[model samples]
Target: MDQTDREILGYSRYVVLAAAFSAMFIISPFEYAWSSMSGHIGAIYGWSPEQVALMFTTFIIFQSVGMLPGGMLRDKYGPRWTTAIAGLFSGVGILSIALGPSYPLVLVLWSVGSFFTGFIYNNAVTTGNKWFADKRGVMTGLIAGAFSWGSLPFIFPIRAIPASAPPETFFTVVYIMAAIIGGVSIVAALLMKDPPSGWKPTGWVPKTKAIARPSEHNYTVSEALKTGQMWVLIVSFVLVSSAGLAGMSNMVAYSNSFHFTATAATAAAGGIALANGFGKLTLGTLSQRLGVENTMILSYIVSGLFLFLTIYAGMNRSEWLFVCAAILAIFFWASLFSLFPIAIGHYFGEAAAGGNYGVLYAIAKGSGGLYGGILSTMLITQHGFPFAITIAGVMAIVAGLILIPLKYSPPIWKDEEAAAQLNARAAVGRR
Candidate 1:
């Protein structure tokens, strides 16, 4: 880093973080709030459960696909244009959904809106790595946590809107939400300013122990794709995310199956949503002390155990156990938002953090939504909820196992000799 860029640029980072947080919070309802309207929308259109759920799948798939271009935009053009475009697509597309006639038309419009939302999401997330490189884990957790928890305020109001409420009223609310998301995001985007390249906080030294350091070389998107470690992390992320996404999509219905009242089921789902945010913050911070790899391993193992316990709780008619276990399972699952991005920055370096992490996040969540949404739904139909839960739990455990190789061979593109030596030592330690 040049001497000019070496000095602390003051507290401007906090401003950037706040902007990212605000944008994430406003845009979040687009994804997390879908469950609130899914049943109603389905009923209104006389669609089957699979058809209603397909909307969510469509959202996830297109949003996931969008992250690649979104990240590339953030890398090349910065957050301002990316987020502004996000505002346009999300706000206008959602508004358009209210007027669209056919279900197929709604799906197409929502996907377009969802795609731009990815731009908002990636730009917001990349802020942490770009601005607070030293505190990537914590910042990413907080920002992503906002995305998770942002839906809480709307969940009840959305649910309370009786199924009999006019469709116009329902969509009117969506319009207001779309406007808020777009407006806040645009203002926040204008407020955002990236620190000069290679910037670091004044007097802040990089930490090597406990937390992983930036990669030895800053690999571009193409370069990052070449590394074996990148592919390993990708697979691990997909597996772990699948388990979590499945749980998230079905938590309310699962709770209802235990015969919990409508209010209680919603409460439980809301609690899990809230816990999801805190889990990101807690585990993300924990990674600083426990090492990201170790934290992820612990998170998956414990999450899987709790998910299995959920089955036991259900069989015993233990609502408390079921709720508690479900919350904890989601807590750990949500931690991936923090862990994966930090790993990406560590593996590929911050220069390409936007694009590299974008592609990784897209693939993981897109594929995960497939497993979690469509496949888990099929499993639930075929073998029952317990069987579905068991599969998800097993997937979590496997994700942890996959990450075990990472400790042995961290990605280090610039220093082959050093990485090899470390790999050798890790291999010996394994024996």
Candidate 2:
């Protein structure tokens, strides 16, 4: 008989789940709330829109790239120390922005903080992979979803801060936010640990009903790299992520460009946050039934269609329609976060999930960040929002089509092991 979680760890795995969820929640504002906060930040710092946008790009670049090393560290040393240190640095990094540092200095601090955000993120989501093999979809969705909607409390207040608000007023809010982020993170970090290798829930059997089964063999990072499937996943991730990031980073400005009222724009931003969070959970659950690959195909195509609709609404100055379409766009777009990690865990095996997914995530999101921030911005400057957003939408649709051919193949070792065992069993039967 398999040992229960209580027998092995002296507690329910939900304890670890709560810790991972909380850690993800606290760090959300670093990305999700940025658009709402950036106008005020730019106003106070006497920076141009271009400069503020570049800072956001910087954050994305560091945050995505930092995941690889962070994942390797977590896989090796465990989550406790890495998360504690990340929490500290992430807090200080955001707080430093309120001190009115030079542009370059603020960029350096934000980059450092964003780097650790990756650590917190990698630690939090992979908890589901480590602890809940049976419930990977639902658990990962919940944790990943937190990274989006957790920004809710911060977004409205940040948006409410008047353009003419005094620097001290903004600084006070920053100080409070920094404290909350650091304090919550440290507390959550204490509760995290990886399950023993090959751990599974007591008496659990792998379900054939689910679309993707757990792999029988573990593939190391180098072995996984040689597969065509990994490269396909990378390309698909980059396309959808670029669309999502562009929407998240630029929605407020895009709304303003359409001459929408402040109230309407704020509503749209809030809508994106809420929908983005819920989408991960909803679609993640659905992926288990429909299969991850099939879900990805549907979600990406629908996400692209919504983006095009969003552009139409904006162009027509239909405030509510624009808000609705943007919400829908993000709802589907954000599922990539939940789905991709589960897909990687399924394909490569959970043994090196953190590092393998980290490598894929870093490369894809890094490129997406560059395209979403710099390239998209340049396109908007020259061709306007309609053209830039259209390009993003088309990319998303193409990404979905790219997944039609992806099917599972066993890792190399699985084949070898099966052949060797078969020969030995044949000889024994003959004897």
Candidate 3:
């Protein structure tokens, strides 16, 4: 293909990836279910609120542990196999949520499914960098936005008003979620595959900030572990992740602190996910131009600011206060989620990225565990959302500070000429 044609194809390929991920995201209605049915399920099952809440935390923990295996799968057979299997798992998981024997058992079973929750999106990120080397920032931004409340569309099917329906009404909601998510997820998994090496899409430029040839830029898991970049990446991902979950676990309370009604709070909570999706798309693309590190720093810092505002808005009870606070939260939280993987592939060779990232990704659920109960108790005991959110906001801001100094790190790959020289030497070694 000609130059323009190749660039167009490259853009098209990246677009295809984003669409696939968004669809893969379509079936994950569980995030929305917490607020949607927590009360109903708790009331009918005679379960304490804390016990039911623990299920969401359980889901996150399993999801994190699951990333280790998932990341290994991504490396062994490539993303298609991992994503397809995950889609199937998610389908079964959701189906089980639809039909439950006991609330505690259901939570345990459903939490098991959260393990596969991230396969599609993470694969899209790792693979998209391979395909769109030239425009990662823009691509990352688009990814950030596309996935922000990826489950937003699925909310309608599962949203049952309190007092409006019997507890058994939840069965219908689960059925709707399972069908919608299961069908789309399976299709998305079927369509997924990584581009063959040397298959650079048209119009794409393989621009690395380094002098090493692209192929020569090999950072194995061990090598990656030795670098400040790895630790920086880890610190960056973990800090932001902790902050986002803290806010996520408490957004309902935060929303109402400002006088928003239950309907408005629920709407706001769901919107955070949608907004986070847009943030992923926009910020992911923006990272392509500004550099992933820079973009990520911006996201966290801005998120931190918005989080502070959320507290103030909650305190003051202003209507317009959090209108944009929620949007910014989406931007920063999703930005961290969407771009860090791209940067990982950039710094560590793709071969080692899976394992190295697995360690980082797997640890994320533990942060949920730490902050989930800890933050909740502090809030209930300490008299408000402000103290907890303030701590998280501080954490998010810290992520920005930690990542900003990463600009000095060398680029992972160089131009073709150097790569050929390395390839020639390797050929001799083989002989």
Best by lDDT: 2
Cα displacement (Å) at residue 276, model 3: 0.5
Write one digit per residue (lDDT tens) for candidate 3, span 142-191: 55444445566655454535566665666776666666666666666555
lDDT for each residue of candidate 1 in 187-268, tens digit (9 for 90 to 100): 9888766666566666677666765574567789998888898898899889998888777787777877778767766766
TM-score between model 1 and native: 0.92
Candidate 3 vs. true structure, TM-score: 0.83
Clashes of 2: 0
TM-score of each: 0.92, 0.95, 0.83
Global lDDT of each candidate: 0.81, 0.86, 0.64
Comparing 1 with 2 on TM-score, the higher-scoring candidate is 2
Misplaced by over 4 Å in model 1 are: 1-11, 212-214, 414-431
Write down the TM-score for model 2: 0.95
Scored by lDDT, model 1 comes in at: 0.81
lDDT of 2 by residue, 363-389 (tens): 998889987887788888889989999
lDDT of 2 at 11: 80
